[model samples]
Target: MKLTVHTFASLDGVMQGPGSPEEDPSGGFDRGGWVVPFMEEDFGRVVDSWFARTTELLFGRTTYDLMAGYWPQVTDPDDAVAAVLNGSPKHLVSMTVTAPSWANTVSVIADDVAGRVRELTNRPGGELQVHGSWRLVQALHEAGLVDEYRIIEFPVVVGEGKRIFRDGATASSFDVVETQVLGSGAVYRVLRPTPFTRGAFSVEDGRETVALDV
Candidate 1:
């Protein structure tokens, strides 16, 4: 079982509050729902296609709460995505979360998230997918637990918000596996981890800034 992590991010790398204005307000982020206007039919089709392949879903506490509070009540409960989300197996990774509000969900309380995830991936069945859990995704990436990454790069840039890649986070290189251009100008890129290649750098005798692309 491969673990595919899917997330939408701004040009500046912010991942918080792409769905609604009031989704997350931490860090004085006022520009919520920045990715809404870019959702076109082509984008929707891409999403639906991706969700169709997922057999298991994982999320963080906050994202789990947000999704559980809304998706279950969608008017079309039998809709493809709604049905998948409502009935599919879900794993919420958190230490403080006491209970899950959604049905067909379980809480994973392990501190060694990567190890737990690896165990899950090695199980006998389908692919596991992670959606909109930046912290957990970052941790998985650092641990090399993520097999594939589906990143929808929106056109807008929110200078202040929770970023996918932040300071002090471990860096990993990715090779582009696939790319799709949405009608909304958002580019959907699928990346897979690859072996790192060394790059040359000139060493200066005096003080200098070493530019590292994270």
Candidate 2:
């Protein structure tokens, strides 16, 4: 299975409190819901495509709590995204949450998160997608367990909030597989993480040249 980190972020990479003021206020983020103004059909379409391929979900404790507190209230039967989220198997990474209240929710509190994730991904051909799990994604990134990234960047910037990519994130590289721009001016990208390969740039014959194999 492919482990994918899917999230909606701002131009500055802020992912918290995108839905509403009450959605997330942990960091005293008064500028909540910064990405709401840019919501449009194109954005929905892109999100729909992203969720369509998800077979399972991985989330952080906070994200799970937030989603559990809201998603069950969305009674729209025609809502594909809501249905997927509510129905798919959810794995929450938390030591505090001993029992998950959500119907299909489970917890991964073991110290061997990488091993457990490997056991999960090695099961079959499916996508174990992580959505809005900023904290958990950090650990997964550090462990080099994340495979793909589907990020939708909004034009607005929340000066203070939890960002998708934090300062201490593991240094790595990825190959951008696809990109699109919605009518709301949101830019979406699909990337595959690859090994970090680096080289130096040199001045050759009065021109700068990249020494990729150096």
> Among these predicted structures, which one has the highest lDDT?
2
Give the alpha-carbon lDDT of every model.
0.84, 0.86
Each candidate's TM vs. the true structure? Answer: 0.89, 0.94
- For model 2, residues 1-41, the per-residue Cα lDDT tens digits are 99999898988888988898888889687887787899999
lDDT of 1 at 201: 49
Model 1: per-residue Cα lDDT over 97-193, one tens digit each: 7767799996565477887888889987677998888888888878878899999999998887887777877666789998988888899999998
Clashing pairs in 2: none
lDDT for 60 (candidate 1)? 83
The lowest-lDDT stretch of 10 consecutive residues in candidate 1 is 205-214
In model 1, pairs of residues that clash are none
Q: Global lDDT for candidate 1? A: 0.84
